[model samples]
Target: MFSSTIQVSVFVFVTALIGFLTYLSCRGQNRSSQNQNREYFLAGGGLAWYFVAGSITLTNLSTDQLVGMNGNQMALLALWEFSAVVGLFVLAKVFLPVYYKFKCTTTTELLEQRYHDKHIRAVISALFFLGSALIFCPAVIYSGSLFMQSMFGVDLPLMYIAVTFVVVGALYAIFGGLRAVAVSDTYSGVLLLTMAVLVVILALQAIDYNFDGIPVERLTLIGDNDSPIPWHTLLTGMIFIQMFYWGTNQVITQRAMAAPSLKEAQKGVFAAAGIRLLIVPAIIVIPGIVSYKLFGDIGDSAYGKIVATVLPDWLSGVFAAAMAAAVLTTFNSNLNSATALYVCDIHESYVNKTPNVPKLSGYVTVLLCLVSLALIPVYQQADSIINLIQQLYGLLSMPILSVFIVGLLFRNVHANAAIGSVLFGVALYSAMSFEFSPMYAPFGLHYIHLMFVTLIACVSFALISNKVIFNQKAEFSLALYKEEEAK
Candidate 1:
């Protein structure tokens, strides 16, 4: 049976209404000026804590978290959810302070400072773009959009609406810039949180009210002993997932920098982290588990079927809308950051030092759209969505985080040391990647391994090289003077 058209229409209308408000909020800004460039690029240093919190939360919560992570949780069923908690806390504590202290636009910028080298900056920035473009954004978009189109019978003509959503999001960033992205994220945050809570509540009620009540085992984190995803994989793999997500990814950190102040930035990071900690179990893991419990079997194809079949009419529609928003917010944020790197870091930094802002933003928007369209084919080629995201994150984070930690923590780190650490980090990560990620351990120590490897390598290189290659001027006075002047 089809979903109630009325409920579906209402859900669609509400989301559209939110989008309209976001557009209007962006209207007050100078959409086509050089002075507006930084604001358009960075939200003008005026990002409210609410939008910062919202955008960060929304960006993190996507089809990757929804479908891919949910799938992982159901596979491991217990240990994975706990890792989610760990990831949230790490983001709240470790990376948040470093980001705020430096006032970084890109995570790589922080690396450049610590390493005292432009090469380090350029390398990390490139990794972020490659990760988002080739892996993160496309996988989520194709999976989420395809799931909705198939579930709702949204034919090809109507299905293009999904592409329109991406285009609109790009324009929002291109024209209105970061301010617009922030406002749109606020709308997405409220809707995503409310809808997730609602779905969880409805699911709990459905389970409680249906049959002879929900089974106690369904509530347990460990589903069955025979599953391939044992607690071992869940715990170890989760450490990698969490640390990379919270500590390294720039799309998430971009919002942190946009916070009104350092205190607000901390609060926003903590708040968003807290919300994400709860959201994964509620909307993703719990529902997937419940669906398996009720339906008795849940293969990869069974996810969408379970949602439509189980939930009430209105709620199902709402779930559809929420999924759409999750994918859009995530894709939008990634695209915006990717363009910012292209415009601010690559074009403005090197090729055309004094390029016009409006024209550059416009050009970057067009380039990203083409790249995204090309990536759609790559997304179609991928089989395991989760694996794709993980692999991408793997290649991106290790090299970049190595450069960043050198910049922030290792004051004596030379440019060559920084650059050398990155080359080594990338080489090691690439070699260890498809394997067991020897970086991931059996104990909780697993999550910190990559961070440890990256940190140790950079710091060691910096220290060893400091005696010979120290830039006394850049280190003692010149860099200090530059930092003072930047302030």
Candidate 2:
């Protein structure tokens, strides 16, 4: 009983310390009234490379990655992290320059500029908002609450813990904006990363570094056809998935875009890429694999159980604090990005040309938080949160990527054509993924491969629909490249 009190005390102390540090770091920076949109959403373009790197890393390195990836309990899942490195590089080298040139506040803003239509931008932004509120936000909350319950052996209802997380995370997004979110993310990231590495070392020690009893498929890097990630699917949809996520997703890209210059943002992205390649893979997968040896097939509960087992009581509190920070950072990052998308892309375009930035964002954040909390029960039924997130994201990921692809790659394409293709891609991927249609089995393709196919189909539909239905010719060329070269 006394040990539990010490653990809770350490958890609260570390959590409060990080929040206080973040408050001090962002104390006077919120005073800018000139271009409140940029100041509030983009941090007035003053974030240094280190904060940018740290925010990008922690924002993506939340409970979803930790609990979900580790839940699989296999080395094969490391491919997700390995592939993400390429995604981050592409974001830095390719997308950053375009965003800088366009001076985009939100990623969808570039679409409006490229297509010369605000409606298409609004459509795409709505999709991003829905994806976050529906899938990413709730999953983070559910998984994080589950982790806390498992780690502390708490008997509290999951909804009670979830509400606490939602309230605290909403406060961060509401009060601090992106600046506080980034600062807190960086601070929490250092603690989380250190603790995660220690957990890895301790887990290995607990198992005496032995791997004799684990199944071969669990230890193998090359996934077979029956595996969650088939080997051939990596060559097809994996790269594009990384591209769409790291390059275009507003929650991740907003950090890079907030930097003062393209070079600074790229530097931050490169640092994040280095971390993903080196540190992220092991910490995410190794603990779960070792837990399998120690506890058998415990599923998503593996990570928290292992942490509780390996760490001393006092240290488990510190780890719990780190995990809580991970949850808050990720949850608030999505909340902040969702607010940015709505205020910049949808609300500003449709309702008011110049709405109150903070006021409007607070309303949006509250609405999103309520919706996310309500959706927590939906994710609770999933077998694997990580895999479910990946599969379910397909409903929007490829379709949205197609819009950016068409908008950037070709000229004279109608905006409605792109919108049409987006709807088409959603319907097609849904029919393929879910059981309402006959496409899933007949294709005999992994979902990853289906993502590549969906992408190609969406792009093709957009171009072809432009020519056939909309009666506009899309002249394909490297116009972005040519323009950059000339500049």
lDDT of each: 0.64, 0.93
- Can you write out model 1's per-residue Cα lDDT over 1-487, one digit (the tens) per residue? 3446866796688778777888787777544454544566677677777788788878877766666644543534434445656765676566666666666677667666565566666766777787777777667667777667655765675337557766766766666667777788778778777866665566557678453444554455654443434344453344755666667777877777776676677677667766756665567665666566667645443456556666667676666777777777787788778776766666666788777776777776666666666677676555556656665565556555555544654455567766666677666655554455564433333322444454456556655565557643224323432332221
- Pairs that collide in candidate 2 are none
Off by over 4 Å in 1: 1-8, 30-37, 73-101, 155-162, 209-244, 296-302, 381-383, 435-487
Model 2 TM-score (2 dp): 0.99
lDDT of 1: 0.64
Q: Which candidate is the best by lDDT?
A: 2
Report the Cα lDDT for residue 276, model 2. Answer: 95
Model 2 residue runs over 4 Å out of place are: 484-487
